[model samples]
Target chain A: MTGSVLAGFPATTIRWRDQLDTPAVVVDLDIVERNLRRGAEFAASASVDFRPHIKTHKIPALARAQLELGACGITAQKVSEAEIMADAGLDDILISFNILGRTKLQRLRALAERVRLRTVADNATVIDGLSSAFSGTPDRLGVLVELDGALKRCGVPTVEHAMDHARKVDRAAGLRFDGFMIYPAPDHWQDALTFLAACKDAALQAGLDPRVLSTGGSPDMVKFAPDANVTEYRAGSYIYNDRALVSMGGASVSDCALTVHATVVSTPTPTRAIIDAGSKSLSSDLFGLSGFGMVRNRSDADIFALSEEHGHIEFADGAPAVGDHIAIIPNHACVVSNLTDHVQFVRGDYWVGEQRVEARGTVQ
Target chain B: MTGSVLAGFPATTIRWRDQLDTPAVVVDLDIVERNLRRGAEFAASASVDFRPHIKTHKIPALARAQLELGACGITAQKVSEAEIMADAGLDDILISFNILGRTKLQRLRALAERVRLRTVADNATVIDGLSSAFSGTPDRLGVLVELDGALKRCGVPTVEHAMDHARKVDRAAGLRFDGFMIYPAPDHWQDALTFLAACKDAALQAGLDPRVLSTGGSPDMVKFAPDANVTEYRAGSYIYNDRALVSMGGASVSDCALTVHATVVSTPTPTRAIIDAGSKSLSSDLFGLSGFGMVRNRSDADIFALSEEHGHIEFADGAPAVGDHIAIIPNHACVVSNLTDHVQFVRGDYWVGEQRVEARGTVQ
Candidate 1:
């Protein structure tokens, strides 16, 4: 049986890959550093503070490498995640999520005391909760007014509503209206830039200091122009491209650093084979794509379906035999980090070691 | 804010529920016990060995409860998962997936010494590995020949092939051909029973004992007839029903014991709101269903889309307001267990403390 699409890696890496336990997540540090350097260079050219979201890797070491590569700060989606990063010595973090509830607010308050922390608020309820917990604190929490740009998931629907929330944030106790943020949708750059400009103009007219205009979505990071209105870009999936990112026009498969290593456990039919990887290993996030993931270097084969412990593969010819190890590039890279407890890191000819996903399930 | 769909519970449970952090998985002990008893009673009536799959909860406590409630053994989907259960003192485990690779086979050998461990193998390659690892041991490893009856996954395709594999297991050293296993598809019980009967007759004619004729898949277990040929039934998702189960006619919404606790984080528009629970929390298993999950007690709202940390809700008349707490029965409950580190167990008036998911990502 052929080794893998990564069969071209160093013989040491190749042999090491073959020896790994099946259904393993392998992250190539060589590719990771290359992707990080590219993102840092792009951010430098665009004059935006690059805050690489740690949701992709969830490893403190990778977060530190992102910072060392020129990110001003990092972006965490949950307070629990930000707390983990803070415990690992990451000082500056922008939790690009709405912080709510009393117990979580107190913990968020504690987290803010330990780091240069910031968060987003799209409604008065969240702002009120943050105010109640942090009103008497010495350091006011930085708040970013999230706008309902093209994504339209969690943000104020209109600029008027956004300005209203911005003003409310400005007047709220123990909270400073630091900036604007949006997890903008890809393929709508013109409308997104327009929305950001209008929000910035409205903030200026209201005599508010809108210091940061952050826009993010990894696919559009490639289109960031020199004169783009946003001051920061948060790209989570850029560091490890997946089929979603590649199909979304962000990066090619060659740039993807992470892959799920699996073994062919069965060939049920002449044209179909089964791999040990499934929804638990390669997550079941389909980006309107045809299959769950792509087998490395096998355009003739694609993973068709995934049960809890088995991945069904349909091939044109030469179905892989049982016991042949294969590597799969999952549809989404961010959630893959959450599915596994640890990820193996490999350099050119040596095993860098395994890193536990520090925030694997830090949903809260 | 209205408390939750669980508002009908005692004031203590409601108060305790309100105190929980958002995006938490709350498992009702009352409902869990009820579901366990129902599954056990059904299996008893069918005269089959009830081996509840721990892949649903991944908690040793739940597995113990299932065993105490009449489950002869427990079903673990992977060898790593079985190892965790064994470490937790589960005396008998059936890893219903194929066991392959050197490292995993070695661990399986060690686990067999600790517990009565049985596993399924569909091909000669897997049987060869198991035989090599267990040869010369005092206790031969139990092997179940799997037939691809309906759920065309991890099983041999034809009865002839299954007989061949069964004979191979009988002849293989240090391995006992214990039974035949099939994860049959629902709504096709007649064909499934025919296939099972054919395989059983073939084993008898070949002068081998297929002691345990196992047919599983929770959906079809509901239709277990009095004359069902199977000796054991392995049901994984019967413990915690989800939207997929309820919609598939295997369960009802009231039978679902687990719900994701989330707070309305934003009302972006009159018809749409966003909740703190997203794919990271609720998971993204659609199972041909329209939405991600159902908002408890609110027919007016359903979650339509999910981002990494945002759930988009589309509502009709009374859209949920910001800060309102709601519970969501996920599309699939098993995957939800795998997504979180701990699950909050609650009874009528008591808030059972959270239990860590012992093997949340035991997909080796």
Candidate 2:
């Protein structure tokens, strides 16, 4: 018989079957709500405005749920994502990134008309552009001076640089200087705090009130929060702890909210098992992870290699038999969500069935 | 402003108005046709049957084009993929993977009732499973022994081991031993040739005529084709060359057909620019790539880092200004295709516009 006839495997089963589907995305919603409330409660307990970032969870539904629970507002990076949230009535949004170009600025203006929109700037050029577009316009835009600590990704490296941008923002018309923003490097808490303190002193010297000081990375959340100086805690992925975070000892496997359902397609030997979920589904985004991800309940197994559509699981112990389904908690949850159009949310066992990753693949 | 919000900044326009309504798996039809022809022609010139593997490009329309161009049939990894092709009325399929478990065997039995199917077996247990399932069946199963040349992925390591499996298949009821199958390791042409020679001797020793000696792998296709010993050639990625293939000097940037359409969202620094295509859109699958992908036309720029929702492009010469649209050829095209439901196909000047990745996220 030809292979074509034998290969009529099912995608409908993934969409409809109670179980036995290969390469499926699963999320634990109960853990997600708990993760949301934890961050919001932490913000309330710390006595600061809790503007939860929606970038981690792009689903507008999740963003709405967070706002309903106690989030001050939602945060977005792209005008597209922000627009989606705003369209869904997430009116108070901080673009959180520099808004540039006439096209984006016009979109931002439209968004500002419906919401209290703010963006971050590390230099005077961006501030000038913001001022040039919005000056004498009815819509007001809030600008935050980005102070970089050790993370060389973005922002001004020092308090002096941050203050210079802050002064320029204060002088620029239609641009409101709202305070400071900093994305700390891994395990550099003391340095981030020191930079924040310096920014506070520089802002006071510049005669501008620094209202908000935000810091959050799911890994460093516990260490940075409860500080009298830090204003808000913005942590996502705690809602869906992945292998990377689990490896860092940030969260337990039981707390993880997302997992990939994959079937063992080939058990070539006693050591290597080829899985249906490869770089495409489970994702090859390893954040210093030893493997692609960890198979839940199978600690000894390692996802050593990945082809485009196949994951090669190497086990020093024993390989999984062909047709056996393995649940993989990815190294990162957000990327996984973005790859799938929808993810199935199940309450108990895998056979318990599906729900939509309603926000899956919402890159725009 | 929260860090999550700051990170959510979309570098490009999120025009919901321009959104494609129905979810579809998009193909750059022009490139796909070119890739298919190139592969088919390559096989024809080499005097080998072009059994273009349908695993990479799963769409039936593409397969039809390949078959019309003189492809012997198609090689499928999953039963579902084969089933789709079968529904499209194309027969002659070789399922490249080992078939296991009773549920899968039952499915195979049903598939055999429809079309010509050949399957590979690396061990005796799998051969037994196949024989037991099709004992009284009229449709004989063509069985090939998977040989491990150098990739060490699947297959038996030695010729003796492969012959052992082949013997089992020959002894099994309603099963016919075809020949041998080898997936060569990258840059290991000499080792592959040596193994193939050994396989030839082993097949003759086992008193079986090696009519169809199959050797596949895109990277080493040229190395194997010139030898004329291999009867069948299976190559998939040559249709859509990715960043990793380009890096290997196997294909040129022009030959690389697929690209991710992205916009510059955050210009945090003069050197660092953030794009709207993050790991979700761009994917974190590097395949030994230095970064995520190549920003088409920007030779000096390197996508050095990627977060779940952010792609960090470090420009050695100059950064892209915010709002600039950039095209990125990902490290792995197949995985990237699996990530998105559709991709816009643009001709020389974007005149061709966008198309849906119709079977994009079919993991089941």
Candidate 3:
């Protein structure tokens, strides 16, 4: 249970296909390396520092690869995931979520000791928590004032709130007001930049030395420009583009590095076929995709329904037979990465090795 | 990592909260035991052979509890789950899925040697795989022909297909055609029973002995009558009934045993609060519920949106503050059970112990 399952996998017809069971996750190193290189190129062309959010693929190897490809650091949502990446020898990290609670903050404080740690504080509670955790520490932790963007999930709602939070973080004993973080930069990147610029101007006028303005949206990352004023970008799903990315013109279908290789278990109706991947395997994160997932090489099939262990595919043109292997590009690659313990690695169609989903099921 | 995370859990004013990290899964043992006892009592009154599906909990202790409460056996959806239960000393287990592929079949054969292994077959491919795996064995393995119900995910489509598959299973070497299986026995379970009876009539007319008809739907299982002709009832979600069940009037909120304890990390807006639990903790499965989950105690807060690590809860009246602890009963419990390695066990508000989710990520 602790190690990679290298043996007892079902055999595949492809000469070097790893015998991973159905609903097996496979990450093609070819596409991954290419995607990483392209991301670096995009960042260099845009004059923005690249720091991938490790929440996409928690594999330590991928984080190392990103650093080797000129990534400044990595972003994680949890202290536990950051701890894993830290243990893997990535020195710089930014936990993008609001780090709250005593246990998490205590762990965050310890993590700060080992790495160049930075985190975001959208509200006063988070700032206060950080202040308590690091008040007496030798090195103050860096805090980014998270500004609300298109996603509307987290962050300060307005420049007024942002200014207040930034000032609060700066006044905190154990924190440094380092930068700004605008998440899901959206297609309207210019609008976000305008807001960020307003926030930055306020910070500068208030005599605050804001070091970076980190912004990210996988679809908008490539559209970023030098005058965008964002010094750093964090993209989680860019490396393993999924169906959502392809549809949004973020990446091509072939650019998808991770795919679920599922076997058709039942052809219940003439138009309906059941695959082995379901919500448990391929997550139920539709993320605006019309279906559960997009089947590779089967444009006619629609993965219409999903249960715990079955994905129903309805097709008119391509009749699937039971035991037929199919590849699926999930809607969101990040959620899929968190499902399996380890993903089978492949180069093209040939099985190479396995990369463990190193930080999977890390609750904290 | 194999053992329970018993250290460094944040202290709570509530004694013995098990200190599981936020986005922690805590199942109430009192409710679980009551649920188990009620399920046994239902089986006795309904006059059906009880086989609680371990797919819901996938905890060996829960399976043993079910057996201790008079369950003739336990039902699992995957061979690997059955293998895990077998390792836990559960002898009679029915894997109620089409077990296909070479490795799965070989493992199924190995599992049959240790337990009274049973499975279902909806197609010729699955039947052939079973025959190939079990052929030359001393004893025949039990197989129930799956009849497609309202779920339309899997199962033989028609009575003829069910009879044909059942006869094929009977003819195959080292295979015994035990009964029928209809999934999602709907509100109109009589219709599914009608279909099962038709398939049974065909088998009986062909001089075949169909001993049991396994019908299961968490909601409809209670509506089942003694005259259902179904000798076996396999209810998966009855143990930890979720929001879906509560919404469907299958069970009340108090009947739900599993609840996610998450802390409010951000109150970004007056009406919106963000919790640490998200798609990674409470799965993105919206089984007809409007939002991600229903918040416990706070009836006003609507968990409307969920990202990978943040659940955005919007409330008009709650005015939730940051650092507030909220328990959410997810829309679906089975998917949540798979997202965690182990769950905290409690009697009520006080955490007592932990139970390892023994068969999580079992691909086969």
Candidate 4:
């Protein structure tokens, strides 16, 4: 709000940890490092490639830290994000989402020229678009067939359908047939493993080498290890476990690195108090969860609803007074990271600095 | 997604309207102008001050246009937003929400020095905060006692409680009691009117002058005119009536000036199709609506679900093919504006330019 640019931490000798502007996303750097190491250690123990999805934090420094912690590469959901990461010197990147249209394809081709870029496709339409865009380019685009294991958001419906798309990529002059990409639900890990194995077999029978079987989900990754079917694992929200991760038994609340630091701006009644954080900050991504978000360390209170800039909380007793700060664990942390331009980094109540969400608003 | 900045419309001779990137918020400039003029005229005929909430569009040019078309000033929900408008040379502004904390109070005091600013408070704590922040300043801060008519998100619960806060503002060193502010639901307009009158009477009896009785709601504003109890009206979403407004009979589908222009990326089945517009673009504000969004001109289809970057649509019969553009009327336009950084401005079928959402991410 001040006309002055947000220049990291304030220059005052006083600690600014407790004086952060309300409705700000505060990251616990200690938990973030622990999460990064935990994911990397797990993938190393399983002897599989770890590609941390940068779409979660969207912080270039965090991605570099992940790489330094032994991650093979980073994954992005949009080409604009990959472009930003590439500019940040993250050369090895995989855009996990499908790319369409000439504008996005041109951007994708430019990104492919700068990085070891791999993209996913589930249909021939997208494969053809990629082929047309990268045919004359020097770098052959790595195109993986997206398989619909359980999350029916995007991807081919069946293994045979994925094989069809894989064959199309194999036949395209400018495309290289990467194995497959599947984001499985927690309960569908077995199905994802089975379908991915079938895809690998189908590609081998068609004389195409299936190099990377990329499958990932934060919850499923916690339950199932990377097996022979999956050559690499991709997970984003594990970097900042949220309430959704806790509900899915992926991690405890202690593992949550990201918390929205909000102030109780109004205690309108005996039971109701309003925080400054709202859907615009915490986001409306319920992810099948119940309330808007969970008040950290305040199990007695409920963030029942949210308007654009107000979070309505109801307390059982001892409601927070105005000017009190409350830490809120949002339902989904990835969306929250995308909502803000910068996040305050902290280390055990000590303010470290502010990290720019470099990939925020990179929605293609 | 392109690395190149969105240089307004493309300079090439080729038509760029059909080639626009997917999942872009496109505003019909003609309809925007018409909606602005209509709202201003309605407020004028009703003989009440029109303070359009800038949270809906967040574009400074549109806010300036509203002021030129007889809007008295602008209303913002956050101090950060008011700062942006004030930076754009809007002198008269009302931040219609509670402000707390030294960080925000310092910013508020700085903003008050540059503009004629008014803020709302429902609790004594907030009034005290404002009083302490402005006691020594040359400018007296205008404080409005927010009343809880029906929207219990924030505000004092009773007229007497509001009068108590008004008296506190009157007694404060550098604060002026500026009547009351109430955002009522459509069904509670009568209650809001009655409560405002009671508060006004109570303040007058307490030897305080209630100058501004600001009552606002887009749905209620369409059905009820500002009467003697209310001196001004504030409505934001009326400028770009969304699906929630259409369902409430506030505006017809044709009156919606804002539409998310998205591309059908995939048709995985006979009845199911996927669009590029997802929660990041169209937003997840159902506002009690059934679906995430309504596909314009395709009433038979429903945007039933959304992932982070994909909208799932199921058709009754026909399905859109890949690369087809669909205009989606989001459940709420204000959140969508906050989601995107730029809105494609269009005139009928012709692409005009891009409007920067200057107030986007101003959720301090």
lDDT of 4 by residue, A292-315 (tens): 888988888888888999998999
Clashing pairs in 1: none
Error of 2 at A309 (Å): 2.8
lDDT of 4 by residue, B124-220 (tens): 8899999999999987999999988666698887987897899889999889998999998659888888999999988888889899999988887
If both were scored by lDDT, which would come out higher, candidate 1 or candidate 3? 1
Worst 10 residues of 1 chain B by lDDT: B1-10
TM-score of 1: 0.95
Candidate 4 regions exceeding 4 Å error are A1-14, B1-16
What tens-digit string does per-residue lDDT give for candidate 3 at B135-207?
8999999999988887878887788888888789989998999989887534657888888878878889999
By DockQ: ranked, best first:
1, 3, 4, 2
What docking class should model 1 receive?
A: medium
Give the fraction of true interface contacts kept by model 2: 0.48
Off by over 4 Å in 3: A1-14, A18-20, B1-14, B17-20
Q: How far does residue B125 in candidate 2 sit from its true spot (Å)?
A: 5.6
Give model 3's TM-score versus the native structure: 0.95
Weakest ten-residue segment in model 4 chain A by summed lDDT: A1-10
| Global lDDT of each candidate | 0.86, 0.72, 0.85, 0.86
- Return whichever of 2 and 4 wins on TM-score: 4
Better TM-score candidate (1, 2): 1
